[model samples]
Target: MSMKHLKYCPELNQITGSINATILLLQLEYWFAKMTGGKFYKFLDSCEHELYKQGDSWVEELGFSKQEFRTAFSKIGKVYTSKKAFKESKDLFNGKYYASYYDRIKGLTYYIRNDAKLSELFDDDSNKILYSEEKSTENTEDVLRTPQIIIPANPKTSSPLSVEYNKLLTSVKDTHPTKVCVPYETIKALFNQYCPSYPQLTLLTAKRKTLLKKLWYDMGQTLENFKQAFLSAENSDFLSGRLGSWRASFDWLIQEDKFVALLEGCYTNNRRQSQFSPSTPSAPKPHSKFTTMYSHYWDFEELEKLEDQYIDRQIAKYSTMSVALD
Candidate 1:
């Protein structure tokens, strides 16, 4: 099963507990940035908040004590520069007594995007584990063989799926809906990309089709938004796990609040703006007028009592009129 956090690292297999905790802590930091649409530099910023405590909680969840967590971070400088766990790259940040910057503001991003180690952990099958060399060969072949269709440079204006979407769909699902005569190949491609272990979507199930339709028409998210969210989830350690693996999924992501939350960078270091502060900002909120203004103010309990009395009076008047007529 896919894990929301990296529970095991081959490098930490035979390391001291302190070193293991340190490496795990670093991975947790990376995972935090991945979930949020922000960079890891935010973690190293001067701003102080509960982010460290949150990391501690994760360490505790991973079967380490809070003291160990604290000690790991405290000793990070000594251990990291010692060339113990990860070898220091030639790239250096001009800080006193520091070699490679732990923040890795740009280098980490470059690696995650380019380095094979950070990208795909296991194959799609979830059964077989391929070595880095073998995986690289397969990836190269897949790229060369994939159809070189040019995705529109400005997909937002065109409101169309990206080249990545087209390649993913043609490779996997490739469904064409007959009833609507409007093929939703884009949605199919997203589902396939989001959940590759599922059977190829030659046809979408009724439930799946309705969900896709509402996500597009009701939610009003374009194919580009879908593509971006898919990539975000793909990189997130918490969301890309297979269904029933305690990680978020495509369906969860499509929810109104969840989609907006992901897009807003709630999970990322961009959330520093919402951190605890001495005084809260008085920014005007959306729909504030709706909450502030009301045409009439009636006490709910009084209104209910008045309504019941009016109903009784009407019944009595109707009874008297019937008697008089009789």
Candidate 2:
């Protein structure tokens, strides 16, 4: 029976605790207030709100009580940094400092609860004893090497499976769907160039195939996802690398106060005229060419409606334009 055990994830614990300690402490305070009828076990309030008012400035000028603050801080720090000793130690009835909502006695019995000793530190032994081991489920890597590797699938045979199998495939798992095998030559090349420290034999065809399948499968998925995303983009040309620095093409012009005639013509249109015509009849805003080509492309139909609604005024104004008569 395979079993798994919980070990401290040190990096995660350090990061989470450092950033969330203030929030956790406040939660503890709220719980304490509810459990103990709005009373705080910690003797003094934090300097900011309860004890001192803001903008007084003289409050900070009055100076800190080093002995009192240090005594309280040490009690809390020990609970965080030293878990083993803390879980095993006995609690004192009149400990000088205490964490908020901390249990003083177990199940309301007078017997002291180790969890509450204000100055106590948690030790390693107690933590080790408290943690329990659990069984783990089979994962992809494990499934790949068990039943398949048990009876060395005849690597020497050149059956349909045989052609795909090299000397290295004798140890793959039955759950593995692929008949493909890693050639001995690829393993030899990589081992020589990258991992000479380990015995070259360890990268035998079997192990190499397993490692390569995982690495290649993951890379293929990521690459395919990126391709799909780029394909779905509104500006397909930019993603396919056709408009190379077409993004930066305008940066120099704008920065140097220069303008291209083509861009200006596009923005102003060929005739420097507004597309709206009072008598010619107006479609809904969503259908407007300016909105479609210039503003963020809303659905063309929706743009027509918005334009029409805004243009439908009780008082309409008419304007004239010069048309070239040939």
Candidate 3:
């Protein structure tokens, strides 16, 4: 039987415990090589590291329906053990063989296991010869070439990301690369300690992780910078719900715009004087000259009585003059 297009070892399916998983792994390896310009390995910080792909794209390209793709994708990390004496124990497996990080907005990023059992499968001399032949036939029409062999390095002890991203130090010269790994747990602790009034972060969800990573890269990529940002948030009365109903949350504080505004002291209390403060009572205006000259004669109540009596006399005189005329 001639298997021309896609050549994969049967052992791959056996080890991964699913034919779909084997196909998915091979496909990922093929794309990783293409994305990295024929290189077997590339660090996440490299310019060409935007390897996030939507699941639908994978489904369309791989000719698998959404359900099949999801099932295969989930099984990429699992490693099945060999058949045991008992049939019931045959399906048991050890730790995960891959590490993946899923950002709801950015899609999925994955790394293969760097252990010996999987490495031997790719590093075989036969596999290399097959890969060379595939590379030579690059111009062939409709020919899906076998993927290049990727020999990943031993897994790293300390993971930069969460437990999900453990064991991904793949074939780099520096085993401990100096990438700005976001210490999510430590930052969460700092946020809880400093911004006590804000909502406590019980779970580091995918959305929160995405925001935290963006913030770590955008602002200074250091724990101290994060600490300072949290401290600033703590000091802001507006962020603590003292000045307004809205309070700053872990998510809100780590947002790019809000975090920048916080570091710039935009929300800091300026302690301006209140608008309702009592003003100094103005001095009474000096008495006008006319009032001062006639101050003694100016009796408001007595003048009113005199004016009424004069009006009464005028009325009686007018009455007598009318009687004479008649």
The global C-alpha lDDT for each of the candidates, from Candidate 1 onward, is 0.38, 0.28, 0.50
Over all chains combined, what TM-score does candidate 3 have? 0.30
Superposed on all Cα atoms, the candidates' RMSDs to the truth, in angstroms, are 28.9, 31.4, 36.1
Best lDDT goes to which candidate?
A: 3
Q: Write the per-residue lDDT of candidate 1 for residues 1-326, one digit (tens) a residue.
A: 11122323333324324444434434443444344322122232122343443423333343343333433443322222122112333222111111222222221211111112222322354212211122233433122111112122222343244667446424422232434432377766765655443333477667666666655643333676676555555444335432225656556776755765555344442112232221322222334323433455768678646644553454345445545654
Worst 10-residue stretch by lDDT in candidate 1?
A: 106-115
Across residues 208-268, which tens digit of lDDT does each residue of candidate 2 receive? Answer: 4565454333223233322222122212223212233332221221221122111212122
Candidate 2 residue runs with Cα over 4 Å from true position: 1-176, 181-184, 202-208, 221-326
Per-prediction backbone clash count: 2, 24, 1
91: Cα error in model 1, Å:
35
- The lDDT, on a scale of 0 to 1, for candidate 1 is 0.38
Minimum summed lDDT over a 10-residue window in model 3 is located at 79-88
Per-residue error (Å), model 1, residue 131: 69
Q: Rank all candidate structures by their TM-score, best first, as comma-separated numbers.
A: 3, 1, 2
